[model samples]
Target: MNLVTPPEHPFAQFVRILGKGKRGARNLSREEARDAMGMLLDGKVEESQLGAFLMLLRHKEESAEEMAGFTEAVRARLQTPAIAVDLDWPSYAGKKRHLPWFLLAAKALANSGVRILLHGGGAHTAGRLYSEQLLETLDIRLCRDWQQVEKALDQQQLAFIPLGDWMPPLQHMIDLRNILGLRSPIHSLARILNPLNARCGLQSIFHPGYQAVHREASQLLGDTAVVIKGEGGEIEINPDASSHLYGTANGVNWDEEWPALAAMRHVKPASLIPEHLLACWRGEASDAYGQLAIISTMALALRGLGEPRDTAINRAEALWASRHQVART
Candidate 1:
């Protein structure tokens, strides 16, 4: 009997294509990226290949085409329910310096009748407060599956799906942070994965160049999205600093600069208390920084929904003022 050697693994081509050399390496085309990500998500790739592929992409700083393709692959694998969702909120970047005030903004929007879908990779990074851990405290439903997501949306107008529940492989990649010593491209791709096909996608990026990449990728996917350099990399605007908004509207891309909410910078809290979110909502506490963050974040969402800048600010303020009535209803 003669022994025969197997051919190269199909996934190896992608890794090779990316790792060829500094001059030879190039970003994957949309189709190739889709195929590569599909293999990764399906667990068809080898363990070594997964690490190599991720780090290669990380080194190259994934292009808009690559991100759009990765997002396409993830969305294809998603079992999204037929729910009317107005916004797709991806909160993978956990908050460290500030409390996740964006959660309150999202809740208020849901209360005002905007159906939203929020998703995140759980608390993979230590010393950070993830939305997954605080959803229950905020009274937002954390759904485990499509059925639960549908029900939550029908009842609460908002639902949060943890990445582990929808796509375990991506969550696993995020969890490899400590071992890898650097975050993989999953963090970037997850933000653009609007699995539910919502009308608007809100994404936050902390790194300097990623905002444009996210904005362009969403445009490539024909998604109306808003990208902001939010507080602590979560999708909450800092009241003390001006925010630049990169977004797509009606197939056209646009950029805008939002003035800071406060005339002067305010000191950050020494520690974050989750209950403050609930207390503020219940009118039991008043925090200027937190309140401005919520209102400004809501304004960004409203702008993504086609409201003019000034109108969005005004509407956000009105919504914040009337939140108690909306919460009761």
Candidate 2:
């Protein structure tokens, strides 16, 4: 007869560090958080302790140290091949009000020879249409693995990988939303992971208050990024609303506000159709609102990638005007 020995709970100590009440509980230092997250990604922690540890981090806001450490651990677990990427665009936010205008912008940039790596997850929240849902409509395939991501980029300069494929533990953590009835820290960590360590990263928040925290955390990760209070918390700029962009530009911190390109219009469209994005890209759709949204978002991305503001704007406009998706095909 053989007896099964229980696995040691390696994460219990870190959980205790954060779970103790006011006097005893303290935030994990970068190193401690790194160790804990490493254990999490390595499958070293038990399920019960994992839930407790996640909630504890969520209860008290995640610090810059924690975010940095967690991301560092994630990168360590990934065996990413050497892939040159011009931009890291992450989209986990689902859009209820509008089609993803940013998708068009990303493709347009790719059309202009920019290599973009778009990664995201879906349905952390129920009832909203996420980015992955629009792939078929856009004629872009969802990369099932890292090799596919590289191949897609090589063939078209644009590729999208879901978070579930990029990192399974993160996907599992994000899935806990349905279980815990609240978002765990992975939601924040997923957004900030520029897996390729790209030169430019794009992020946004729904709540205006988290703007500062996201900005500072991006800085802490030592990855160049641009953060904004984007439409429905996505990186798509609302052409009708002024967008304040916060991040490191040219290795220097920047806080710049881009004024609205059009007047406020509160009327929601009758439908949210993904095909319109394809139409807009192919010059078959004449939506003033949609076009402005795409151009402004592309301009923001170019700026984050080190283009001067004026040059970014001019190039973005030119890229928009010269779009020939239909003509090329």
Candidate 3:
């Protein structure tokens, strides 16, 4: 019997580099990570190799530079419309405890004529409601492609591009959640992807530690971004708890604290009917918690777009108050 050994794969090399014994294993350099991620996104890596690379990276906890590299590959491959987008909003984390209050915030921003490109994917884990699943109930534009994103922006000024529709390979990595039994590095990288090279970005994470990670990577990527530990981990503020906000604008870095909006702690709604999101938007429902969360989230987006704190907060409140009463078209 004659058996030729299979050629060593570049991805396998990458896996070995990261998975080498404790002392031997080290994080990949920016360039190395960029190459690895580029290969993964292009479907050049074998499935088994892909799984190993993702798990290894996740276990090591990616560095800011590594995150920057992975995000670089993702941003390059995105199909963006020609339209000018003022904001980049990524909403990967699904709503586990609250309805998506940030969707209303995006809507209010759009009503005020701020063109936003909101992108995300979620519900890879059970018992969660992602933006894609609930945004439709409000009739918010859920674009299937860059063309639809363009049209939605032209018509509505706010649009969402679900990860699966915009970047299937990345979504495939995310979809591996069930098999992997843990989140992969793609979650953080996907949230940092400013696909259209927008002027500003808004990000939220469940962990407080990633604030610096996201801010540094955004700085390296040469854009302004605001990050916080949002409610239910979905870029929506927690009215019941103060938020630690971190970001950078221009050449300056920022670390600030935003006080909670609701006076008292809130209990998760007994049941979440997606319709409540729309009702709140339409002025038919007025839960103080939902209202404050929406306004605070909008203010964060405005701050990312270069508004001063007081101005952003004030403008967000005004925008929320004056939003259209009619349902989304």
129-245 in candidate 2: lDDT tens per residue?
788888888866689888998898888888989999879888998888888888887877788899987778898877656777777777877778888888887889998889898
**What residue pairs are clashing in model 3?**
none
Ranking of all candidate structures by their TM-score, best first: 1, 3, 2
The sequence of per-residue lDDT tens digits that candidate 1 reaches over residues 114-213 is: 8899999988889999998898798899898989998988888899999899899999999887888899999988888888889999999999999999
Q: For model 2, state the Cα shift of residue 238 in Å.
A: 1.0
Per-residue lDDT of 1-329 in model 3, one digit per residue for the tens? Answer: 99999988767878998999899999888888888989998989999998888898888888899998888887777666577899888888888678889888888888888888988876788888888787768777988888998898888888888888878999999999899889998998887888887888888878767888889988888888888888887888887889888888785788888887887898789877788888888878788788888988888888888788789999888888888842343
- In model 1, residue pairs whose N, Cα or C atoms come closer than 3 Å (at least 3 residues apart or on different chains), thus clashing, are none
Off by over 4 Å in 2: 1-8, 249-251, 325-329
Candidate lDDT scores, in order, read: 0.90, 0.84, 0.85
For all predictions, the C-alpha RMSD in Å is 1.6, 3.3, 2.2
TM-score of 2: 0.92
- Backbone clashes, each candidate: 0, 0, 0
Q: Give the TM-score of candidate 1.
A: 0.96
Cand. 1 Cα-lDDT: 0.90
Q: TM per model?
A: 0.96, 0.92, 0.95
Pairs of residues clashing in candidate 2: none
